[model samples]
Target: MTAPPTAPATSNAVGRRVSWQTGVSILVMVCAVYLARRHWPVIESGAARLAVADRGWLLVATAATAATWVCSALAQQGAVARPLPARRLVAVQFAASAANHLLPAGLGAGAVNLRFLTRCGLPVGRSATALAVKATAGTVVRGFLIAVLALACPGVIHPPHVPAVAVAVAVAVVGVGVVLLKGPLRRALRAVLADVRAVHELPARAAALWGGSLAFASLHAAVVIAVTQALDLPLPPAQVALAYLAASSAAVLLPTPGGLGALDAALALALTLAGAPGSAAASAVLGYRLLTVWLPLLPGLLALGVLIRRRVV
Candidate 1:
């Protein structure tokens, strides 16, 4: 009698859980459709531009976009001493990119990678630490690239002049924010530093971490540059690269999913500042987004779903 009651109870719990998952999936699909409809005009315009783009240059952009996933996989592998399955790692990065765009900032990608690491035998805490280390390396490499490119293309990205009072206020605000978050920040910093040290102890890991990060950022810039070339945007390659790096860095501040609006606006503005016409700048930005985001999105999501069903991530 007890067994019969327990069986129905277990079935009910499982049914409820499945129903909840179905509801969430439906909600996500609805939101995605709504967003697509809202941005239909922009999507149409980008598609028009891409339709006439130089095939050779567009091919280059596509290749670079694909290589980015491989680079990302390399960086993730570098985040820990243990060897991960290379093929699965690359596929997970592709899926993670789609996941990343679905959530604000990088929460989705981080969660996916965390799950992957845990599934690969890493402890939860260690998995989180590895993510932090990979993120830190990427950040450092991006900033370095920006600084170098800015110097190379002198005057390409002019910093906005701020009033002394505004600068002082910004500094004060940052100081206060730091003070308030000091405890948690300090603990996090310690963990990241510890992981950084451990990862650096292996020369191969260090090289993969830093080198992969460099390649990832550079390839993204290359994609933008290739788009500009394909469209005959009348900007030097170096200037375009500089504009992309600077705009992408600024986009980081907004924390939008996939840096959607923020990156689009910033890249357009940067390209315009770099001497491309408004229409050309817009086309370049759209083309870049098309290749990087829209094209890969469906396939990446499919991969994510497959990984989930297989319990791979």
Candidate 2:
């Protein structure tokens, strides 16, 4: 038989692994801090705006911001039939939010949730598919809301004027690309279609998937509206809500972590376009970002550390 492994060598290996992980974590945190510093001017402007906001309204916005994690948990649960522990799901989401800001797009959040789901007994493929399902539902619901809102507020939601030739060319390019990639695309489509059918077979799961997605997007917009009201911005609630939807939809095209720079710019632009003064619009966007992203960031990071140490995520 081969010689048994040495205890000392195993210990050393484990120690090195932990040290490497710790170093990587520290680097991510440093990156987060550097990015935050770069946005100090926006943060300062938002804080100034917050100083004059109505305290009661601001409190309401804070409460709504806190509820986003609950919405996330519900959406995740709806994505799969496996019953995840409710408290743990919420906690994972809280930690994932911080992790989400550390990486581009949503890779951080997706990784965190995938691990949690796998630990909860899902196979890796199922976990990934669950994430895709939740994301698909959220996108569909948000698009539906945009369509409805645009129809409701015709005056504020003007369609962009793309040249007919450009549209035709883009359509032709996309069609050709799809045709060229039919084999892989067809297989992927089949897998997604199977998962969709399986998921919707359970009425409650189907409802949760669609309903939770809608609630998450709507609540996010509500948070922005509440911030505008707190700042006493002279825009109708519907207009503010529509602007939020449009801006966030457009921001999704960018790959920023938590939509950092892209979202800030879009929010400010949308608010300004909706008739708010430039300063007030900037302040409103900043306040909303402050509540949703920055304030909870540190706490979320701490929670992520705790979860990692406990091996719960």
Candidate 3:
């Protein structure tokens, strides 16, 4: 008998899939190159600032930056019920952070983690749910910290005055959107709530989820604070922390990769409003970016390449 008719169809399908993946990889590389070109000046400035920053305080910021990756790994683990290989989990988080910087609104990081979870034997639906749980926890913890810090350091961040009519229109728009998307929204909410309940039933998982998220946010703020201290930005630690939280939270509204440009502008402005001189605020922002983004970026990307080569993610 001749070859089965289905063999040709299977080969064609495999060829199409490979082509699609290759196209996507090329597009991602193009976007990354464009972003790097656009942000080169800022990166150079940040590096210059880091060179002159107080070594002691810079060391503190560096340490905090390293810890944030560990916190991310812990939170991710807490999202799923099954145990993940500890070393590989942390390495993936590092890789994810580099990916986050390359794609908008956390898409790269999410994709990386989703692949990792599926590789580790989780069903696709469950892996997605776990990601949602971790993201929800992170958002809640960040907002809680902002609110607490705002109250503790009154006047650190002044609320912008909004026209009543403008506020009403915004609320109305959100209400209409919610009504339109209620079905999908409801389903997603239910799924996330179910996962949350299941994860919380285990004390270790619950603690890791909440504690790791809290620590992750706190450590990031600490990095900014340390940078400010290093450069003598004349801002109190609490105020710097509040500025970081508020700026970063607001920056989420703009879906640029890793909050790159958007976060830089918002953070500098927040610092200025909090009484730091413009130059000093700019330096502190640059310094923060240097330690958090530029420094670890290459190593993270290398780790990502290695993981891919090993078919680990």
* TM-score rank order: 2, 1, 3
Q: Which candidate ranks first by TM-score, i.e. highest?
A: 2
lDDT per residue, candidate 2, 214-296, as tens digits?
A: 88888889999999999899998888989999998888889898888888898889889989999889888889999988878
Q: TM-score per candidate, in order?
A: 0.90, 0.91, 0.89
How well is each residue in 122-237 modelled by candidate 1, as lDDT tens digits?
99989999999999899999889888987888878788888999999999999998999999889988988999999999999999999999999999999999999999989999
Q: Which residue ranges in model 3 land beyond 4 Å of their true spot?
A: 1-38
- Residue 175 C-alpha lDDT in model 3: 100
Q: Where does model 1 exceed 4 Å of error?
A: 1-38
Better of 1 and 3 by lDDT: 3
* Model 2 residue 58 distance off true place after TM-score fit, in angstroms: 0.7
Superposed Cα deviation of residue 145, candidate 2 (Å): 1.5
lDDT of each: 0.88, 0.86, 0.89
Residue 71's lDDT in candidate 1: 99
* Predicted structure with the largest lDDT when compared to the true one: 3
Those runs of model 2 whose alpha carbons end farther than 4 Å from true positions after fitting are 1-13
